[model samples]
Target: MKTRAVRMYGEMDLRLEEFELPEIKDDEILVKVISDSICMSTYKLAKQGKKHKRAPQDIDVNPIITGHECSGVIVQVGEKWKDKYKVGDKWALQPALNYQGKLDSPGYSYRFCGGDATYCIMPHEVMELDALLPYDGEAFYQASLGEPMSCVIGGYHANYHTNKQNYNHAMGTKKDGNILIMGGCGPMGLGAVSYGIRFENKPKRIVVTDVDDAKLERAASVISPEFAASKGVELIYFNSSKENAEEELLALTDGHGYDDVFVYVPFKPVAEMGDRLLAFDGCMNFFAGPTDNQFKSEINLYNAHYTSTHILGTTGGNNDDLLEALQLAAKGEINPSVMVTHVGGLDAVADTTCNLPGIPGGKKLCYTQFDMPLTAIDDFEELGKKDELFAKLDESCKAHNGLWNPEAEKILFAHFNVEI
Candidate 1:
């Protein structure tokens, strides 16, 4: 099969080219990738290339395709797995396959198996680890976003508090407790806030803070306070950039502090602020991954000694978390569309992935079968004036509160005369 994908040849060297894919082995499967969500990790990989642990050292000689967060339809099933999986089944992938302690993964290590392609092969290891998950959602973008949402779920699951009687650790967030999410207006941070409000071990109140007023406004609009009230949770958006913001934020909790605090940005001040806002047995989660190896933040050790305040960190989610993400999305309990801000085609993957950090907004979603530039949903109306395709897309998205949805995806595919 011939596939067009963005492949990494060396450090900061990415190419969009067409190539023939070798036939899938009996233990492998073939899929027609529909949608992929660009991640910052892919930007890091493009910059680091062979130096990355998951990237093969011989990438210059043998390039690997570069997208990971994707969802698609099974086109061909290998004989070895025909009984387990069949053609025409929708699927989502959990890419963090720490298989047998090996660092290699789909998007970083495989030549013919990645998301930035019209078609790709799934190796046997993916099935062996059960990383290829069955998805029955109407929208493929939801499955593509499941990977990031799962990481948010994992962070929530990783939080733990201590039992005073035995000094034992209790898993998960405290139920009916006050929660704080710092620097929470970006894509992942928005996911954290959405999940916290709908989570089973629900928080009584969720306070989300961010430095940018625009981001805070967008986050509030996407995940409204009315929605939180309907879910029996109190939601508040605070601007951390304001003077005496910390003091003002604390006053909202009646000076009791928070039972659970999450740091969504790698900024040291935010981390330290989260530490100071901890309640007696509060569990603080550092959710953002920093590029610096020596990233440090000051912690209130006095609270750790006198109270039961502690901290932990999570980089990604496990398989169980991905499953939960998929289940919640399918059930309409959580809207993954809130994370998506831009839409593009496979032609835009390389450039978008290479400069992801420079672009402001949330997830950049791409469809693998067409050619279109990366355009923000917020700018759809302006772009629509020049092209009817974007006009229809703008109409569809605007009908859904300026968020990407199944109707918008359908409109896009229909414009390209491509069947989903």
Candidate 2:
């Protein structure tokens, strides 16, 4: 079978290419990808073209597939996986496959068998050992959310603060605690907001700050009324670009300080703000993975010590976290689809990643099947007409209770095959 995937070979270069699938082994299974969400890691690799430390060397040398957060249905199950995962069963494919020495597991260690492809082969090591969520739900978003929710769960389990550097597992459960999520408008930050709000019956206040007001408003709408009312969680939006943003955060917490702060932005300024806003004994969770060599923040060490503030960072989640994330999504506790503001086919992924980060909106999802059907015009008059078309679409989105329309979808879809 031929599958579509984004291949990276050089800096700021990505191409949607098709590759031949290998025959499944007795201990493996073939899955047809249903939905996959674009992650920050994907964006980094697509633009930077740097070899990820965790990625296998072979993947770096060869053209590698770029998606990790995805969900699919089992189409062909080999003999060994027949009893465990039958054909026609929907499952969340774990991205991290630990192929110690054997053929690389799909969607795991090798960057080649990613979710961007139409079909991916999973070896027994990944099939039997990694997390698999049986999708008995109505939507595919639940399965797709497994990748991220699992990371949050792992972060929860990895102990935010400890006397011994690597031996503690103290999950945050303090009552009346407040969490400040920097860059809360992004998908990861929004997930943190959902987790901080919905986990347990504990009443917690979540304040999400971002530079873009539009993105902040979108996040606010998702957590409105029902989730906020039931969880006793208030989702407050703040503009971090403002001069007195830190002061604003202090005022919101009544000068006591935030109990936990999740830094979702990778820039240095955001990190500094997180360090400054933390209360005594508070834990600052660095959710964004900064560049490998980029030590972007200058922390106030004196304050960090005197106040006993804890700072921690985490990567992808383990198997347990992935399962829990799927379960939560299954229960409709978190709507992963709500984060999807834009959707296009495989060809649109490269341009979407390049431009969407600068756009003020939600996540952009790439569907591997459909090819966008739109024509491009170069005349100035035609360009003016195109601008009008987009304006009308934006108006329609706002008018229809905040839903994306067909025209906006077309515009986003058209940019996929643009010359890079």
CA shift of 5, model 2, Å: 3.0
Off by over 4 Å in 2: 56-61, 98-112, 157-169, 201-203, 225-227, 354-356, 373-420
* Candidate 2: pairs in clash: 97-108
User: Measured by TM-score, how close is model 1 to the native structure?
Assistant: 0.98
lDDT of 1: 0.91
Candidate 1 — worst ten consecutive residues by lDDT sum? 161-170
Q: For every model shown, what is its TM-score relative to the native structure?
A: 0.98, 0.81
User: lDDT (0-100) at residue 193 of candidate 2?
Assistant: 70
Ten contiguous residues with the weakest lDDT in model 2: 372-381
Give per-residue CA lDDT, model 2, range 53-119, as digits (tens).
Answer: 5444554467666677777678888897666777788787666555664534343245436777777
Local lDDT at 223 for model 2: 62
Q: Pick by TM-score: which candidate is best? A: 1
Q: What TM-score should be assigned to candidate 2?
A: 0.81
